[model samples]
Target: MLVTERTLAREIAPAVERSLPGVEVLAVEMLSPSRFCVYVDHPEGVDHALCARVTQLLDDYRASYTIDVSSPGVERPLRKPAHFRAAVGQEVQIRTATPLAGKKRFRGAVVAADERHLRLAAGDEAVDIPYEAIVRGNLIDEGQVQP
Candidate 1:
C-alpha cells in the first residue's frame, strides 16, 4: 500500500484537531521519503507546548517516518479560499498555473478576495486571479525593511 502525503494529512488532521480543538492544520508537506513537515496554528498563537502536543499525538505515525511540527511563520502559505480571505489587505506573492497578465508571477497587496477570485494591487496595476489558477501563494512579510 502506498501512503501519499495527502493521505497522511487526511489521516493525521483529524487526530490533531481532536487532540487540540482550536488548532488549525495549515499544511502537510513531504520534504523527503522519511521526513514530513506539518504546519499548524491556533487563534491565540503557536508555541513550543503546542508543537510538543502535536508531536505526542502523532507518535504512532512517527514510527516509520519523521514528523516536524511547526508554525506557519511570517511567510505563511495561502492554500485555501479561507486563507486568501484572511490575507486581504496584506502583501502577497502568487504564481499562477498559466500567465494571467502576461506573467505567471505577481507580487502585491491583496485588496479583496472571494470564493472565485482575488484582486491584487501591484503598484498602479490591479490583477484579478481566480482561485483555481493559483499554483502557489504566500503572504509577504513587509515588516522586514529591504535595503
Candidate 2:
C-alpha cells in the first residue's frame, strides 16, 4: 500500500512541534512528488502577524519544497460532529458525495444539530440534512477580519 503525504506529515509532526510551539498543525498533504501542503493554526486570540512570520520560517528552510500556508475560516469546517457542535449559529458550506434534492452542495446558516441531523436555514427555508449525508462541511466567515 502507498503511504499518503498526510501520513508522512503526521510522522514528521513531532519534529515540527519541537521547533514551533503553540502552532496548530492541521494537515500535510503531498501536492506532487516533491511538493507538500501544510495546514496550520494557532489560538483565536494569538497574533496573526507573528504567525505569518513563523509560516515564513517553515517555508524558508524547505525552499526546495512547495509549501502552502493558510488558516481555518468561519466554517473552520467540520471533520467530525464535534466540529459541527463547536460551530453552532455560524454559516456553513456543505457538500455531499451524492446529490440531495438534485444538488450536491448547500450553503446556509447552521441553526442547530442533534445526534442524527443538522438544521440549516437559508433565508426563510430551513432544511434538515442527516449527519450521514454530509460528505464535508466548512464554517464560512460572514464578517471581515479586524487587523
Candidate 3:
C-alpha cells in the first residue's frame, strides 16, 4: 500500500523534533502525485538553513516524491484547531464546503476557536463556523481586503 500523507508526516515528525527542538511541523500538503510541501515553524523563525536541514533529513522519501520545506509566512494556512487558536484576534479568510448564512466565504477577525468551531467577527456580525464545514482557511494581512 502507498504511504499516505498523514503516515509520512507521522514518520518524519520524530526526526524533525530530534534535529530541531521546538520547531513544529505546521502542515504537509501534497502539491501533486509526486510533489509535496512541508511547512515548519519555530518561535525564533525559520530560515534557509532550517528548511535545507529538514529537506535533507527527509531524504528517504525523496525517491518517490520531491519535497519542499518552507516557512508559514505572513498569510499562514490554518488546518487544525491549534492553528485556528493561534490566529485568534487576527484577520482571517475562510471558505466553507457548503454555504452558511447564504455565503460560503467569510473574511473577518477571529474572535475565538474551540475544537468544534471558530467565531469570527465581521463588522457588526459574529459568525460561528464549524470546523467540519471549512474547506480552506488562511490569515489575511491588514489592507489585503478592500472596503
Worst ten in a row by lDDT for model 1: 1-10
lDDT of each residue in 27-117, candidate 1, tens digit only: 7767888888888999999999999999999999788889999999998978678999999999899988789989999999999999999
TM-score each candidate: 0.76, 0.53, 0.77
Q: Which of the two candidates, 1 or 3, achieves a greater lDDT against the reference?
A: 1
lDDT of 1 at 138: 84
Best by TM-score: 3
Clashes of 1: 0
Q: In model 3, which range of ten residues has the least summed lDDT?
A: 1-10
* lDDT (C-alpha) at residue 25 in model 1: 86
TM-score ranking, best first: 3, 1, 2
* Stretches > 4 Å off in candidate 3: 1-15, 97-104
Candidate lDDT (C-alpha), each: 0.86, 0.64, 0.85
